[model samples]
Target: MTNNTQNGFFKLTKFEFTAIAIIMISPLLFSWSMYFQGLLIIVMLWIILGLSWNLMAGYTGQVSFGHAAFFGIGAYAAALPYFHWRISPWWGLITGPIVAVAFGYFLGKLVFKLKGPYFALGTLASGEILRIIFGEEELITNGHNGIFYMTTWTSKLPYFYIAAALAIFSILIIRKIIQSKLGFYFLSIREDQDAAEALGIDTVKYKNLSLAISAAMAGVAGAFYMIYMGFIDPEVVFALHNISIITILVGIIGGVGTIWGPAVGAIVMIFIQELFRSSLFGLGPEWLSRLHSLVFGALVVLIILYMAGGIVGDWPIIANKIKSWKNKTEGQS
Candidate 1:
């Protein structure tokens, strides 16, 4: 990594800090409706997931298509105890990441052997296999019947606060990791595994370490989802398109390999999602909501074509274009 990249790893500008402060105090500042609060909570969850995916695929150059495997397992880690022994699902907040890291460790052993698209395919299959396994293992997992429980809080306030804290925590942890030597190792691996290994770096070991951290973060998000939503099923947690693909999009659209890119991506994604889901808050026709998936896909295509570096990644280019347009308009006037 260049000196600028290393320095930029954890350094937050005033604008970014202001945004963080606004999110931290959002509930206190505005007496928002429960619906809006719910949206905020979901956005925070995605922020965590996005950051998790970014750490592995962005920093470490290991593009995983099976994040849902960690996510679903984290959720199930919490749900199983609740289903079998009537233990509080809240305990999943602790066990979720542990189990996720364990699974990631073993999975890394198998998939890390492959490189590039093959690795991606391996991960994609792992998630699907877990989904099937969980669905079939009725004796332990309750099979496809799923797990249901009444949520602890009636209001969304507590959940929002918890989610916000987790998001902040995720940001801090990732920033710290990126500033350390491990972060450099990850960058080296991403740049070229062979070169990193030639320089005496243990590529496999570091890759596993990166995956562990990523898995833990995803696991925590999944556990939080289970407790807040008060329900979980194989399909909901391990859905290939919803969890895995959306996680990838979050990384890509936010500016993969950039520290704050995922955060920006999460906000954009959730806003777009809710806007369409509500059919422009009922202003547009109901059928407009049905096109959200199509719109999202098209947006991704546009981003890849024109904004390959992502919103944050390509901010300099975007700013320059805006500046030129302003100057041209002034000259014309």
Candidate 2:
């Protein structure tokens, strides 16, 4: 079992290296143009969001349903500076993460005592509260009116490159955490907090650290989002639905606890959404919008039931099993 796990890890590492290389070189190989650049930015944003959520929910086994609160906080942090003081968003990149980490620390302190479903409910309630506050505070957040970002000389390509760099950076951070001692601590805590504590692991500290890191990454993504869209509203940034959808779908479709799982899940979900929006629009039915959600929801359910290990996890297992079978057959022959 140890050997098999090690081999699996090696194979996954190689595959990740290759995939990242391909992604880095994609723009040079294919002309993405300007219009496609925006799409890439969106994909990269989702990748960052998915990866950050995976770090918290996947590895730590702390299912936070309210990550969108940090995301919204980051977006507002960036936008508020630019709108009020005419400051560059570059500064917000630093401030956003700081604010998010602080908020995450508070959240961890508040809810780490709770276990399982209670923790999830706490996060969900916190998210709802943030949404309500943002929506009601018209004087600060502009309420339902939203805030328009000031235009800059930076074009869509810069934003695309920025998003791509952030995605890569996030993946690298996750990969490092997974391979480090901290990862083992997180895994131990996930399996059994009491056992981990008995083994001398500081479960609370590690959990808070993981939460802070995850929130900071999400904040960075949200900060960039404000710059990319040049506008943000409480409805768009602080929406609980967005939080639930991204966290649930990414972790479910991708192999939770694996570095590349959430990223792969984000890519698949985004492509599916785009395909549905493009191809299903004129299918001669007014009810087609419902079909998209229905199909996606069904797919999520099936993935959860059959592929609990996630696409990333199961794909390698199946591939290795086939290979082993083939080798055995050849030996018999």
* lDDT tens digits, residue span 1-333, model 1: 124334453476666678778998886654558888888999899999999999999999999999999999999999999999999999999999999999999999899999999999999999999999999999999989999989999988899999998998898788778888999999999999999999999999999999999999999999999999999999999999999999999889999998888998999888887789889989999998997777778888899999999998998899999999999999999
Q: Which has the greatest TM-score?
A: 1
Give candidate 1's TM-score.
Answer: 0.95
- What is candidate 2's CA lDDT for residue 320? 91
Among all windows of ten consecutive residues in candidate 1, which has the lowest summed lDDT?
1-10
Each model's Cα RMSD: 2.2, 4.3
Model 1 scores what on Cα lDDT?
A: 0.92
The number of clashing residue pairs in each candidate reads 0, 0
The reply for model 1, stretches above 4 Å from the true place, is 1-13, 28-30
